[model samples]
Target: MEPLSAEEIRRSFVNSTKSQVKSMALPAKFTELPWESLDFLGWRDAKAPNRGYLVVRRDGGVTGIAVSTQASGAARRFAGLCDLCNTAHHVSDVALFAARRAGTAGREGNTVGMYICADLACSLYIRGLKELDVPQGETAAPEVRADRLTTRLESFVQRVLA
Candidate 1:
């Protein structure tokens, strides 16, 4: 992923209105993100407890989406697997986040939700930069896992735009 500027990010959102984009908050470490290791940029908003954001460059432009955390419940008692990285995380560290679809579909209240890491650090997780308790005996090579993570994330983003 390429390093992005605030203006570029603000103009990238597909579902948010002009006002919403203007009011949206960037991630806490927005200016210092590890862009080289990421397939997409995502984070749980620092100030908005239940809000999240994701952005990726595609089709010659950037596309961004806002996400909201679903209410926690008994379902959260069990470990959850992130759909994007296929990583298992502690139930408390996994969140059901939903993004409104792009364009007209969004205006109709269409949204897509999936279990994801609460910290939105799946990129680092797949790259072995984050410590996980999972066994590594059957794991694929770092490059392979990274490629798969990128592909999976792109597919998820496509669904949001579609």
Candidate 2:
């Protein structure tokens, strides 16, 4: 994935009324992040913690989402297995972070996940894919299906930030 410029990021988030394109602060150690490991365009925020970053792609059009490693104390009442990989996250592996669509609809602060390596693609990896091997006692609804999981997470992130 190619790195995105600040202008590209700002333009992508034109629809997000609530989201602002500010520099992210990243931890100094995070400088070693493997950009090549990502599938979509990703970048670390220079002004904020190094853990702060953004990922962008053309889901239908130019859709960009922001991500941060900062954790929230909000308790998790909702428990469900990942629809894609079928892994159990005990509400911890699954966290509610903030995000927003990068276009006209970008004002929404959606919630997303972090530390989701079970599926390997962060949000999408944990969300079940066709090849995923779901574990026993783990079930997901159509609304929480793998494909929709990422989008749902994004919405959750928006709510948290908002």
Candidate 3:
């Protein structure tokens, strides 16, 4: 992944309005992010825990989406795997986050949701930068896992765009 500026990130959002983008907050220490180690930029809004953001570099451009957590009762009772990273997490560590669809579909209240790490730290988890008490149970190399994470994440983003 390449480093992104605040302006680029704001402009890349496809499902949010100018005012919403203007109000969205970047992750803390945004300038110090480890870009090379990130598959996509993701974080919960500093001021609004329910709101989350994901940004990825595709072909030659960037795409970003704003997502919000679903109501709490939807969480699983046992450990769950993250759809994007295939990482296992305690029930409390995973949550269902939903993003409104892009364009007309979004205006109609359509949304897409998937179970993912609550902290939006899939990249770090995939790269072993973050410690997990339980194993991911995959035999792939870190690079391969990273590639898979990017593919899955992009697919989810595509669904939102569709």
Top lDDT hit: 3
lDDT by residue for model 3 (29-120), tens: 99899898999999999888899999999996999999999544554557778888889987778889999999999999999999888889
Q: For candidate 1, give the lDDT.
A: 0.80
Candidate 3, run of 10 with poorest lDDT:
70-79
* Ranking of models by lDDT: 3, 1, 2
- Candidate 3 TM-score, C-alpha based: 0.93
Task: Pull out the clashing pairs in model 1.
Answer: none
Cα-based lDDT at residue 103, candidate 3: 100
* Better candidate by TM-score, 1 or 3: 3
How far does residue 17 in candidate 1 sit from its true spot (Å)?
A: 1.3
For residues 19-65, write the lDDT of model 2, one tens digit per residue: 44544333244445444443443334556432344444544444555
Of 2 and 3, the candidate ranking higher by TM-score: 3
Which candidate would rank higher by lDDT, 1 or 2?
1
* Cα lDDT, model 2, residue 105: 43
Model 1 shows how many backbone clashes?
Answer: 0
Where is model 2 poorest over a 10-residue stretch in terms of lDDT? Answer: 125-134
Residue 15, model 2: lDDT of 28
RMSD value for candidate 3: 2.0
Candidate order (TM-score):
3, 1, 2
**Higher-lDDT candidate among 2 and 3?**
3
